[model samples]
Target chain A: MVKSIPLTKADVLHLLSEIVDPEIPVVNIQEMGMLRDVLLSGDSCEVLLTPTYNGCPAMGIIEQDILLLLQQHGIPNAKVKLVYAPAWTTDWMSDSTKEKLKHYGIAAPLHSSCVNWLKPDQITVACPNCGSEETLLVSRFGSTACKALYRCNGCKEPFEYFKCH
Target chain B: MTLQEALFNYLLRLGDNALIQGHRLSEWCSKAPVLEEDLALTNMALDQIGAAQAFLKYAGAIENKGRSEDDLAYKRAERQFFNNLMTELPIGDFSFTIAKQLLLSSFEFFLFRGLSQSKDQTIANIAAKTLKEVHYHLAHSRDWCFRLGKGTEVSHEKLQNSVNALWMYTDELFEMGEADEVLMEAGIVFSLKEIKPKWLELVSGILDDANIALPNVDYMQTGSRKGIHTEHLGHLLSEMQFLQRAYPDASW
Candidate 1:
């Protein structure tokens, strides 16, 4: 075999950072914490992505984007695998992503140890539109599986928020 | 049957329902009336397929079968399927499709809600995850049902006809079999009888909001729980299993 330059996991992660989510274009996979793991052997790369939700529609597009990103960088034998174990949660999102989502007019998830829906005081989701702590959930579900419908008391605009599971 | 066997069969029905319905919806990918609706339909179909994969994987594990989700979905024959008859019906017009979705999602909402409270942790976890998706699907279908039922006269008439034709098949969904009995006894699954009243109430509320009346005809019950499907399933399987049958080991 001709001398093949070895690739590193860091290089693969760098490449995946270029793949932005299709629905939410402001943040790339890395920012959203969607890129779970990357392995590299010689010139081949394997990327792992955790879906936002169990049946997220953006998953297919994200996989394709990762493939294209690697292929463009001359990594011909790249493979993308989806791992569902240790399931993804809003808690995995980075601080930058939280800021970006707020700036993009979507409420970022509230961090809470309690998963109980009956305890409203325990879960406090900040409003993204007007930076208000006074927001109410309009519906438990939103237009998509990953989001919940909410309205801000400050801005009075209904917005979608990624629910913290 | 053991609790494991009952759980496997129950998961199989859930997976089969989603897989068959997803396959049916995918047939309309490029043929939808508008681009947005097309994307929406395909997105919904993909969601169902993903849910099927989760359930099928769980079922395989419960059965101690080394089969993958793809093997369970693609390799199974029509007679081996255990989905309710509502899932396998042809997607006629937009109205008919919406009507089917409304009925199916309403049933699924109750099913998942009940499953979430199961004594089995794995089954409850899967149900909790799937309930979120089914909630959105129910809302989407309910919205469309309202629009179709109360919109233009032609739309109303078409939607009414679809509901009337499909209402007869709704009883099959709540029909319990031996597997259900075993699961219920084991607390691995809830009794469908317990879910039926909620399903009826929610479905009726949607119909009432849409200004559509429930058909007075007696409900039809099919033996899909026993692997007997409607005539449409044969044609559907022919198309769905074509590639797998042609080249057994074909992969891209």
Candidate 2:
């Protein structure tokens, strides 16, 4: 007879937090709030994930990362289900992650309730280089789908801001 | 007309548009002008294919024929396809392809926006989901149109010629036949009469911004909605359905 070790949601969440987003290396799955729910039943585990955007290319890579992480911890048969009804927004990001983004030379997203319109009020996006809010959006779309191109007036350097869709 | 039949026809049109345009865009997979553009075009193609799959699957269920999306996409004859003629035209050159994209994406943006408010919940949901990508596609194509139309003299001339060649085909995009009328009456689909003016204004404004002149050609050809397609559609169908025709049950 084979014995299975008991694991709780906390244990699963801890394991999941170690998984980082492939695109933004500094942020982990927990920081991105992509880890919605984790459930365990016997030897199998079920995970609920929300995509950053529809048709996001990073989804496939994120799924693979989840499987590898859980399997490495001796838990096989982990299933990841994508939920699309309650679309993801930057508001779901953790406070610590927001702070870390600023520290890592990237401006964190602003809280905007309006749809289809970029934030009208020029909220300070602390310069990723000089830690100043003097930055301007150069283009709405950037190199990647999740980012927007912005030039920091303080540092006079261009950087990518993870857009708050 | 019955609701089920209307839904069937409506979904079929949506599926055909996506599948045909997806096929055309896929041709630029490795042939885009720049590396970023290559990926962008392929990404848009993948989005269209995904939307086609979703719409076709819903169509099969409404038809109650046990036909899968692939069955509908691959097995249907040219006359059975309900896509606009604009999508079936050949990709002549880089300039021509960009011009076609600029026109088609703008039309789709307006069409899908109205569709997001459709009475049919399934169609509405899919349209809302797909509109975000369509919005980006329009922006990308519009930016390119301006660059190519206002760039070097050669590029400007080539892009202008491409736009003129494609202008006559734009009328076919807003042609509403019996199926369209039935769906429009049921509020399942929006009327093209309402959609046409906005489409024309947006497209014309983009061309004007690029310093490109709109063709004065008033005579237009229209037949794709009623199953009468251009000479180009048959060749496109043959190439698209070749593998499926050769091996009926082939699986990836």
Candidate 3:
């Protein structure tokens, strides 16, 4: 039987980058900045992940996918740990990912400091579909807690705006 | 309480507050007056449970007893819970529920804002993340309070009575205990005394805008810091803890 070389951390990260986020299939977890760090000892690997929000439902699926991806890539012993310190913010998401989200019909998150809940007029949300500035908030909440429902009059299309934390 | 014990107890109070309030909100799952309201409340409930898990997990780590977040939340007896009595009080009418949230969410917003500066890195980090959510919660509840208070004759009457009834319980949120004293001295926790005035100003301003009178309540309820809660908490725990009790060590 021919033996194969043990995978390195770079190899593992490259392979894991192929796994797309279950919620937003257009962006990989790495591009979303969800993969905090990866540590390898012998053939075993440990991945530290931080969730976008404390209760993001996507975390469980991402953790499972990470483990499965590692296993399929010839690493049998991979552990994924969830950590809360240095809590995640949308700022971690790259500019490229934000553009990808907009192209996929979901508006990217705005800067958190600019959000004033009392004065919706203070914030400007552009519709992802028609790129129009005339968007009304349909609801403070959308399909998920992290998103807000907005409707664009220009295109008459309702879209989910990823809310800033 | 020793400093370590005080820290543990403080964490329990924070965690229990989130857990109990989340459970109360979850009860409106399919029963809300509208579908949007149902989804909104449940979303808030999910955020609270997430906060509860984080605080309780840290508490367990500090205790060094190997108790996970589930063990602390599900296995604890009613008397052992340290959530404010206001949280465990029954969710009465929609008006009452709105009033409850207005008070609780305002309190939480200020509490988390101050706690975000905690000397303990873990607590500060968690508080920073949750503060934004609590801010939105306060906005939602306060907006609804104004609408319900000024809507119609029936709506105004119901909302007025509900806010007045919940006013007395608001004082209990500021009741300090040994745990609070210890944590406050260490800069690991904020002084509830300081947060009270800010909360009162915000509440009073909203009530004024809503054309509702502030109740002159001298008598205040207390005893949550000492693990004393209303009868409603026991029923809530029974329902919440049933699955864990029925199947010990069960995992999916």
User: i-RMS, every candidate?
Assistant: 5.2, 3.9, 1.9
The window of 10 residues in a row where model 1 chain A has the poorest summed lDDT is: A112-121
Clashing pairs in 2: A127-A132
Better of 2 and 3 by DockQ: 3
> What would the per-residue lDDT of candidate 1 be over residues B22-119, giving only the tens digit for each residue?
88888888897775467657767877888898889888887786987877877889898898998999999999998999999889888988888888
On residues B51-163, what C-alpha lDDT tens digit does candidate 2 reach at each position?
A: 78778988999999899998999999999988888888888888898899899988888888898888887788777767766766777778778788889999999999999
Candidate closest to the true structure, highest lDDT: 3
TM-score of structure candidate 2:
0.78
In order of appearance, the predictions have TM-scores of 0.74, 0.78, 0.94
The residue pairs in collision within model 1 are none
Q: Across residues A1-165, which tens digit of lDDT does each residue of candidate 2 receive?
A: 544636788998998988888878889887897878997776768999976655566888999999998888887778998764354667888788988887776677766454343123344556667776788866545566666567988879988776665
Interface RMSD of 3: 1.9
Which segments of candidate 2 are over 4 A away from where they belong?
A1-164
Query: B154, model 1: CA deviation in Å?
Result: 1.2
Model 3 chain B — which ten-residue stretch has the worst lDDT? B134-143
By TM-score, the better pick of 2 and 3 is 3
Model 2 residue A58 CA deviation (Å) reads: 4.8
DockQ of each: 0.20, 0.20, 0.54
